[model samples]
Target: MSRKAYSFVRGFSAQPARDLCVDRHYLLCASTGALRLAAADRVWLLPPARAALIEAGHPVRVDLPQPATTASVLFDTAFTTPPPAPLTVFDLSPLARALLAECGQWGASEEPLTAYAETLFAALAAVTWRLAEQPSPVVLPAGRSPLLRHALRFTGERLGGEIRFEEVAAEVGLAPRSLARRFATETGMTWRATLRRMRVLRAIEELSAADTPVTTIAHRVGYTSLSAFNAAFQELTGRTPTEYRASFRP
Candidate 1:
């Protein structure tokens, strides 16, 4: 059997993007900018000192404010023990952060680094599961409009498929003009802008997973062609799919 790659990225945030799951699981820490995850009727807000646990096959939407820094780890599906729930925000303990920092500086030493990283990974998973068991306050946007909520749910369900404004408007029983206005008013973003973020979030999951090819992943996530996918991925991630995969090697 082929071994799955584990991905790690640590850098300053540039802009907001969307990510859809491929096969890998993601653990993310954002020093600034908020991260949002929406699954069906559920939408979550991850603030500082919190990390988001994104499961495979779930479509997540992310938004980063002006400037932010983030550290993320992508591991194979097999590596993740089942969480009590699909998504949870956990406190990134001091030890978890320190270990992640050490892993960042481990360089090319596979021996010691691998062992230490595994330990850290275990601790991270435990913390996330523990947090999931405990109820944390959930914050949903105040006065969220029905149209915006409908759009978000529609996006999450169809992350791997195509989406059009007209289709979304029809689903929500609104005209295109009316839907656009409602989206902006409730979500603080245009329908197109929200769709773009949703697409990027789906792409992140595809890029992080092991079995999917970049071209296929791109098409699956709504890019018409490979070039478009590459451009979008680079714009959001600062690295190509191949380069990102290499960072995750175990």
Candidate 2:
């Protein structure tokens, strides 16, 4: 297995645009603007004080939503353990950022730089683990009714299985019609839209661990047809399943 690790900084240019084809998992922290990951029309926003854990082989179109400075560290599977996923958004601590900066300056020197880089890597790993141990803060959109919380929580917990709007409504003690209206009003997305997000997140998690067949992943996330699963995955990730897997391999 080929193992490589390095650290660097990125300053966004005017009209920034780059689609990175990563061969290893990458940890990135932004100092300004926002980092957006697009899969078709869907976008995940990353702002400063946060880090984005992009999985190996995931073809991501990245752009600075505004002028920004980003510091990043890349590590292959040999150098770092694969993170638990849908891609992780971690709250970056000041100490962690400073350590990363110092590591970047070391530039592969053999003695002191090697020692410092090792220590920095250890700290980074510890910080990432601590963040993962914390619970996710669910952010409900304004105008969303309290009733929708139960349905959302249920979907999140059962993302590995098939979900239907009727089932979600029944679980919440509402008719499908009423539930649909309320869900749209409160969440600003239909139940189907929410399900898609959940499924995509699940797929990302699986992809990070190992190269499982896309069909298996699609089924695990509740798609009955492989073609449909591929379509959905590409529509959201802007890359085919094979392309995503290839990015992580050495």
Candidate 3:
């Protein structure tokens, strides 16, 4: 499997932290249950109807729960250019999901398997194009407010350190009340909510690397205590830090 130019994995089980040193891009689509894919800078929360695109040689660790079904394919870079980013979590419609499953089921000698891989790759490329033309299913708001923009730049620069809201407002020549109101009005989320989201997203990226412990991640992301970070993480993503990091463990 390690030396093969193409591979397909379909099963009803879980996978521990592992790395494949192949020059083939990997596409994973989940049909039922849930799986977590952990990479260097991102932890993908993959559920039904979601797909993850990973670049060739970019290591990922997979963890799955019981009653789970997923189809993954490894193909040459000729199929599609490397993803523009390190990680992209996009919606996968049912029809495309079935197509992916069908692609995963092809079994034959290496001679045929390699050719069949091209057909599968083409289909996936076409499917990806169609999905891109449609609106993104997952929309995290990034509003345009000059003051808010300045405030964001100011806040973002000091993510792991202290974030004094009043000081931020004062520097920008706006009252704290006005800053909160304008931020909520423009971003559709309160200042605190935005801050939490930013921290959590950054935390997710850091967690995938396995370089940091859960306790340090909480503090690194500005959580005063581990318990507080756990509650906030679960409240937003339905998973705790330990559980999320477990998906990346060997």
Model 2 residue runs over 4 Å out of place are 1-3, 14-18, 39-42, 108-113, 132-250
Count of clashing pairs, candidate 2: 4
Model 2, 1-250: lDDT tens per residue?
Answer: 2225667777885356578768777787766555655433234555455677776777766755356678887776666666675355555566766666666764433333356566677677657646644422211222344577777777767777766778888898999999888877766788887777667656654654455888889888888888887887677656676775554331
Which consecutive 10 residues in model 3 have the weakest lDDT in total? 132-141
Candidates ranked by lDDT: 2, 3, 1
TM-score of each: 0.49, 0.49, 0.51
| Candidate order (TM-score) | 3, 2, 1
Better of 1 and 3 by lDDT: 3
Candidate 1 vs candidate 3: which has greater TM-score?
3
lDDT of each: 0.61, 0.64, 0.64
lDDT of 2 at 205: 48
- Angstrom error of the Cα, residue 42, model 2: value is 5.5
Q: How accurate is candidate 3 locally (lDDT)?
A: 0.64
